[model samples]
Target: MGTSLLTNSSAMTALQTLSMTNKKLDMTQNRIATGQRVSTASDNAAYWSIATTMRSDNKALGAVQDALGLGAATIDTMYTGLNGTVEVVSEIKAKLTAARTPGVDRGKIQSEITELQKQLKNTGDSAVFNGENWISVDSNSTSYNSTKSVVSSFSRAGGVVQIDTVTVDLEAIKLYDKKADATPLTNVVTGASAGTLVAVAGNITVQVGTGATVNVATTTTSTLDSIAKDIMKLGIDGLTVAVGGGQLQFANRASVNGAPAGVTIVLNGGLTAPAALATAPATETGKGILDKSYDAYNGTAWEVFSVANIDISKLTDNAADLAKLETYIAGVDDALGSITNAATNLGAIKNRIGLQQDFVKALVDSLDRGVGQLVDADMNAESTRLQALQTQQQLGIQALSIANGASQSILSLFRG
Candidate 1:
């Protein structure tokens, strides 16, 4: 090649090498300072994008964690309330058992029962968490009962993000139905005309003043007059039962208030046709004091406890009322069983929530490690690379300067 001092090709080659080396050095410095291999989309678009999306998913998982915590707290509160209900009901059963003894003031025993029932209501109302009450029916729910759900997981496959949730059945947990606004035990039975008496086989329960539950039954072939015979037998209790003549009524004896506690004379089995009783349900402020469908012999006959079943203020010291108190005690026992089942259900859900919380924590940690793999720069490796690239940059600059001096030597050959 012909040598030309004006066009030093060697200097240009060295300058290009230095420029490339400087660019590499800058990249190493950036990796060291930012501590990330893919800090921008241009660094490694695919890895950068994957890591960006993973970070977003991690944030969503954080929200799910928060929701799980809230659900656990709510369920715990409900379980506490259910335990309280069990205790109160047990106390009520004990009081009813004590009232069974003869010569004891049943009127006073019933007053204590009334107070215990009030405590049950208080327990249900107070078992609220973040304004959510699992045991109490919501007035605004479209259905009679309500259910609940808690966020559990967030996942992304392809481009779509999906959220998973754990659902709980609230109907099984709640104590009162929507219909029982407050007075749960008050039932109104429709009474038939007294003139049309049809006596079929069935038993009648007369409850008064926390006393024994007096049960009277009639045979299928028996007439209303036979039921009257049964009623007369109870007169010694300071209360009287009147059956037949299209009506069944109970009234306090002359010694007591002399008012009727309840009366039911339906045709089909025990339940009166809704349409038939609509016109004339035994009434005192729009409800009957007696449970029309309840049977003294059948345990399942009594479904729920009502607040108006026995009024202490209106009880009489009659033999009939004292006998009816026995049946009431049995009814209370049935109610306790139901509350215990509900509490068990809440406990099961609480355990599940705790497990979900643990899983979420582990998942978050795994995701952080995954994100690190996609973009995190190793400090040990990057720090060493930074030094090596800096040395190459200095050597390349020196080589370029030495190459440019070769042109100056050619100029010296023609120097004066």
Candidate 2:
């Protein structure tokens, strides 16, 4: 192309090259400054969008991690409480076992047991974290929930987001419930009507109060009514024996010397005395109030007696009282087993939460690396490119200056 005074074609070409070089230099500088190859939709639309969404999901995962932490703390609290309760219940069991020996001061043993029971209650009540207590609960509360859920993870797939959770059954782990319908103290021991029947193959000696010993002969053909009639023939003051539902019932209705006198029925010759005769007498001596009937778990299917209500203070060395003591021990054992199972389950959950925490951390790191690969700039490469583009911009400016100087040559010709 021929040169023209107005056009200056060579200068125009150099000017265009310089402008393009400056734009490229500006872009390299921006990449270095932002540390991102795709900082915006204009840089790389698809990658920027993906990184934005991933960042949002990472925030959600962070919240899930917090939830997991809270859940772990709650479980740890419950486990600690259960472990302490196990120790206390074990102590109570030992005390009850010791009380089984004849001539042992059961009142002293019962005092120890009472303190242990208080400890159990305290442990249950205090096993709380973040205002949550799984050990002791009021089932009648409007907000009570047997199942507790903990947020575990946040996930996204095909543009859809979801949250995952772990759940625990509080009912299985709960030691006590304060529901109004719970079994009362009166039901701690089996009722008199519910006592074991007197079925023996020999004559049985019965002594009620201070009355003389009476022998009631029993044959295979002897009916409970006939036996009861023979005991009634003793004419003991304030003693009444009757047969009801094939079970013998005994009552002492008389007081002695202006004071209430208790009835004591002693049977020999391997004849099991009716539970009615063993019932806590009106005088309330030689009988513990807690020996009535107590149910743990608030009448759940387990139906074991409450360790907290076990009382051997007034229990004698008689067969019936000893038998009642045995029942108390069994109930405590059952409660211990249940608490142990709950602790095991809580431990497993704690382990799982730890594993999940590790997994979440790893997953978050992986996500960071992935987003980095998609959008983050390589500083080494960007710096090198920036240097090269700056050199190119300088060179383009020089070329444009040289091209514009060609117009000076044309001006010289005109002056000549």
Candidate 3:
């Protein structure tokens, strides 16, 4: 028998065909098992890159959804605080109403006032969110340290934007009374003579105008305020009283001691004017306005003078306190509404995320199917192809054997 060469064309051709069939079977197996087309860059570089980018986008969207959830929490906290503040204001308004009633005991009103002040302080201090205070102290100057929790921007216009810090002025509502009601006359000498408040011992009368007069008897050391009231009540048009050098001096608003045009101060009884007079008629000063005179804080303390005292009765007139209360209530209401809106928006965003998640999931499934189409083997088809290849492979082996037999036949000639 002759040896067949290792490089025989029949052997090489069968080996090459078998190798090709094996590679195809392997690819089919990989696709069926792994369920992906672009398992590697070697499989399909372009498809793999596209799938990778899509996955990244899905992750990014999920992260943004998480951030929106956090915003919702912050808004919830703010809403709670606003509601509390509104309740406090409502209570204060009620208390104020009760105190304003006629014949109400001053002590009870004072007690209520003190309580109200405490509540106000609490309201200003208690409203907080996210480790921040929301209220700011009210002062003439614009800037100050704030203690209220301020909700900054959480707007959704393409993206969430933060707003500038807002601070509530709690002290803007606090009220106080001012001292010193009347202005005193200036530039006069008062001792025992010259500008003496008393002409003789133990008797005195200060005349404001021709018919207007203030009689002060038996009382000494009366403040300028005490004497000015008598002069004002006289209805003297322009005449006023001022204390200069211990003497009650009469002067007019016009030129020194001169009345307003036709107005005049005429003295009756034993009253007599000093030869020399003083300039600068006394002017009404201090908290002349009623509103500014009352202590808004406790509502108890007030100026003793008229006009300077704020009419506490006015607060109950339905025209005054209602509008003011409503104004404050509206602010709280608006804040609460904003919080609700924020929550709603956040919920919508979350819903969108959920939809996106569902879509992404579906997209992933579709992409997987597409990948399967590219690489996965249909088991039925692969099984049939495998059988065909097996048969061909067997036939190639038989044919190679036959070809070797031919080479054997060539050796038979030598055998003969």
TM-score: model 2 vs. ground truth = 0.73
What's the residue-level lDDT of 377 in candidate 2?
Answer: 89
What would the TM-score be for candidate 1 when compared with the true structure? Answer: 0.67
* Residue range 92-174, candidate 3, lDDT tens digits: 44554555454555355546545654654455455455554323223333553323223322222444443333333322221
Task: Output the number of the TM-score-best candidate.
Answer: 2
Off by over 4 Å in 3: 1-7, 105-416
Off by over 4 Å in 1: 1-3, 140-145, 158-160, 177-324
Highest lDDT against the true fold, candidate: 2
The sequence of per-residue lDDT tens digits that candidate 1 reaches over residues 1-416 is 76676787888998998898888888888888888889999999999999998999999999999999998998899999888888788888898788776667867887898888777777877989998887766535565335588888899988888898877776556664443221112223334452454546777554443345567776666654455456556543323333322444333212123322332223333324222212222322111111212222111122322432544334345544443454455446655765787778778888988999999999999999999999989989988887888888888889899988876777777779
lDDT of 2 by residue, 144-242 (tens): 888999999999988788898889987668777765322211111112345434445666575544646667777756665566567766654344454
Better of 1 and 2 by lDDT: 2
What's the TM-score of every candidate structure? 0.67, 0.73, 0.39
Q: Is candidate 1 or candidate 3 better by lDDT?
A: 1
